[model samples]
Structure formats: C-alpha cells, structure tokens
Target: MKEVLLVGFGAVGALCTLTSKSLSRSGIARVTAVARSNYGIVRGKYSLCLTTRRSRVCNTVASAADQAYDYVVVTTKAVPELRLTPEILSPLLSPEYTNKFAQPTYLLLQNGLNVEKDLYNAIRKLNQGKPSIVCAALYVGTNLAAPNVVVTNDLVNHFSQRESLFLGIYRHEDHTTSANSADETALLQDLGSIFQRGGSAITIVPEIQRVKFAKNFWNLSFATFATLTGYTVPSLFRSPPASKDEQCNPYLYPITAELVQQHSIPAIKTTMKELLNRDPDNSHVPSMLLDARRSQPMEVEVIVGEVHIDMLYALLLVKQNQILGRMMAQ
Candidate 1:
C-alpha cells in the first residue's frame, strides 16, 4: 500500500484526510495523520478511531525504521500562533530514522506567501538534508460542522463553478528553470487525478507562488476588516449600507465603503495584481476572516505585511512610470 502522512488536522486537514481515505480505499494510497491534540471527534461525523488500520500518531515521531511515506501533507495554519517551525518538528524530523519515513514527498497545504521560504530555513536548521517538497493551494471552502465532521459543498456543484481546489508543486530559486518551469507536471497530473477520483475539482499549475499571492490578497483584506469590527459573515453580508440601517444613519454605508475601498481593497488589489498578475473579480474570504469574526487573534502580520513589503519593492520598479499617476488618482 502507498503510505502518506498528514500533519495538522484542522479544517483543511480534515478535508484532505477524508479525500485521502477515499483514494486509499480505492487502492490509491495508504494514509496516516499526526495531530497535536486528539480531539476525539473532528468536524462532526468521524470519530477518531484507533482501531482502523490507518494510524493517527500524536506526540510521536516516525523514525527511519518506519517505511518512508509517499507523501507528507502539511496543513498547519500559517498564523504566528499556529506556525510550525522545524525546531517544533524536530522530534519527527530527526536523522536517525532517515531510512524510514524521512524521504517522503512533502506538500505544504498552508496559506501565506513566504511559507516555503520559512519552511526551507527552518528545515535547513533542523533536517539532516532537504526532502522533496510540493506546495498545495486548497480552494474549497469548508468548515467544521461537528466534531470529526466537515461540511463541504457538493463536489459536483463546486467543480461546476470552478470552485475546486487549485494545487501546484514548488520551484525553488535553485531550480534551473524559469518561474513557469514544468518540473512537476507528472506529479501534478497524478495529484489532480487523485483529487478528481475523490470527487473534487482541481487545477494543477506550475507556479504555485502566483496563486498563493493572489489568495493572500483576499485573505488580508477580509481578515483586517472583519477583525477590527466584531461582525460575522451573515451580519456583514446582510447588513449592507443601502439596507434598513441607512434610514437612521446615512453615513454608515459610505464610511464602510470608503474604509474598504480606500484602505483594504486598494492595498490588497495593488499588491496582488502587481505581484501575482491576479484579477480583482475573482475574490475569496480567507480563513483569517473567519478567525477574526470569531474573535480570534489575526494573522495580519504574516499575510498582509508580506504583501506590503513586496508591493513596496514592486513600486520601486515603476517609480517613474506615467501610469502611477492614473492609478493613484483614484
């Protein structure tokens, strides 16, 4: 059986695991997952059952004696509070077990722009040597409906609308190829086929960073706005300015629009278009937004700050351009 290990079993992790299980049961790959804390129930339906053949290890490391896995999916949240450094993964990253599960193909299913850079630095400090790494951009919108259970939209509807997950392998600077190098075509094709078999929609691109940056823009915008204001999705989406609230206060709508359009929207859009060549029409509410609405600490620094830095450098490249005047005029 082809073996796989998943790290960080949150919302995306749950979806990834379920999809893996379906594929494995169909003889695609054997799967196991490692979680920091074993919440007896995930999402809402599946109970954490140790009796199953597929293992779920907690507070343990897979040494070299254990067979190397085919894939390692890292789904840890990219926020500072939830970040997983190589030192944090030292127990499982030790060299003593290199012969075992150390050489598995790795995939980081996280959000943010510099995750690969951070992971590389962390691993270089902790790992014996580099392992193959792939990057995944999980596009499906899902939430925990119950312990061990996740509620996702129907696969058919999701794919039909092109809301399926967008996945891509990574290309480090050391790789001797252009930004659009076709290194992982076969791997992406395999992954895409696997996801499709599991009833998911998928598009595997060569440059995952572009898509990653694009997603970061939407993430930062929603997270920054929703966090500062204590409002949930239903409330914000329903309570538009032109709605009932405007009768008593005409200023509220324009104020909100100006805040969004002037500060958050422009900053995000400018960064995304300049850096990743992304269009503003395709938008998404990032996980940070969900966390903020629920009164959770924000991931603003990692997601938004990185983009701002990149945008500054981008601005430098076009500092003398005529178009700058037209863009800033708005």
Candidate 2:
C-alpha cells in the first residue's frame, strides 16, 4: 500500500487527510499526519469534522521520520516567517535518515506564485535521486474550526458547481509553449487518478502557473484592499444605492457608505477589471484578509509586493509621458 504523509493540519491539510483516509479505506493507501504541536492530543483524540457534522478520528504521527513516506503533501501557509525547509525536510532528509528512506513525491498545496521553487531547490540540494514534485492550485474554501476539525464551505456544490483542484508538474519554461514529457504526463495522470479515487474533483492542466496567476488576480486586488480596509469579501460586493440621495446619506455607516458610494465603486470596479481581464471567472475570499483577521503575518511580499511594484512602474511611466507631452507642446 502507498504510504502518504501530510504536513500541517490546517483547513487544507485536514481536507487532504480526509481524502487520504478515504484512500486508506479503499486499501490503496495508508496515511499519517505531522502536526507541529498537540502531539499527545492529536494522537489520542484527533478527529476531522465538517461544520455541523460528526467527527471522524484520524491517525497522527509525532514525527515524519517515524516511517518512510511515499508521498508528502504540504498544506502549510506560504509565509516567510515559517522556516519551512528545515522544519519539513530535516526529519526526512537528515544525514542519518536520507539514505534509509526513499525520496518521496512532494506535493505543494500552498498559494502565491512560484511557491514550489524554494522547496524544489531544497530537494535538489539533497543530491539524492530526484523526487517527483507536483504543484496544485486549489479553489476549495475551508477553515479549521477546531484543533482537529476542518469546516468546508459549499463542499456539496464543489463537484457540480466548482472545480476543486488544478494539478501540474513544475516547469520553469512558459507553460503556454512548454509540453510535458511522456514521463511527466504519466506521473500527473497517476496522481490525478489517485486524488479522484479519494473523491476529489481534480483537473490536470499543462500550465498551473496560469491558473495560479488567475487566482492571484482576485487575491491581489480584493484581498489587498480588504486587508487594508477591514472588509469581508461579501461586504465588498454589496449592492450600491440607486439614487444620489441614498448614496449621499450621512446616516449610513461611514465605512459601508464609503465602499458603496459611486466614487469608490468605480475605482473598485476598475481595479478588479484590470486584474481579471485575462481570466474573468476568478473569485475567492483573499486568504491574506483571513490572516490579518487572525493576527497572523500576511504574505505581503508574495501576494501584493509584486503588484505594488508594477503599479509604481506604471505611475512613473505615466509621469514621463506627461513630461514628454508638455515638451512636445512647447
């Protein structure tokens, strides 16, 4: 049987664990999870539950080194504060264990662009046999409701209404022009089948980068604004007043009025339209806003820093164009 190790027990990780358990039930795979804390609690009483549903207990491992894993699914947050490499790899890739354990397939289920590069580099540095590295851009909405329980939103509608996960092998070249080799194609297909067997709706694509960027368009636009303004995703899309009197009413909540006014609505629409011009279907509550609400450090650099830099460059170019226009008029 295939042995799978899942790192992190957050919302995504918990969902993955449920999938792994389904695989285990089918006798195709056995699963274990590695959580940073609450080892005793998880080992004895760990359970994965949906919101308002019964809890199902899960298997927990204190350390990843306890057993050799065939696959490692990383579902941790893609924040720099977490020394991910050392924390994840040291137990499995240390000098003593590296030779004893076979190189495992590493599946990254994190957000942000180019999220797999650093971990991939770390694996290559091991100088062992190259392991298969797969990246997934997931669109499922889930939250950890308790230490051992994960609450998923609209799971029933996911299969019929929404695509859940997009899978692809990591490629440095532009995916639009790049084709996967026969071996890579086989690997991706196999992984996709495994996930499908576990009841996950997965689509294997040639270019996961495009999917990541498309998803990030919504993230960088709405998430950044929401983080700064303390607005929820649903709140941002509230219907505006149809009349000027209603729009200018001072009795309305200050922040709500500001957001729903014609002046602010146009700016919001322009920003969203600019970002989503390439992919209009992209929409989700920004994970960064959730982080801000939880008082966790947001992924400011990866999610918004690049966009902010591009905006600065555009301003500079506009300024230069204005100066050139004045010179021409003179």
- Which candidate's lDDT is highest? 2
Model 2: how large is the Cα RMSD against the reference?
11.8
Residue-by-residue lDDT tens digits, candidate 2, 1-330: 677777777777766655442333334556676666544455565443221122222333334576687777787777654455445556676766777877788888887777677777677778985657888877776766567666565532423334678888876544564567888888887767667777777888776777777667656666666666677555555456787667544586877777688588788767555444323222344566666566555665556554565763353334334444555676
Tens-digit lDDT string for candidate 1 (261-328): 78988897666444434222323344555554344444555576677756533432242132334445
**Candidate 2: Cα lDDT at 190:** 73
> Candidate 1 — worst ten consecutive residues by lDDT sum?
315-324
TM-score of candidate 2 versus the correct structure, residues matched by position: 0.72
Clashes per model (N, Cα, C within 3 A): 15, 0
lDDT of 1: 0.55
Each candidate: what lDDT? 0.55, 0.63
lDDT of 2 at 170: 79
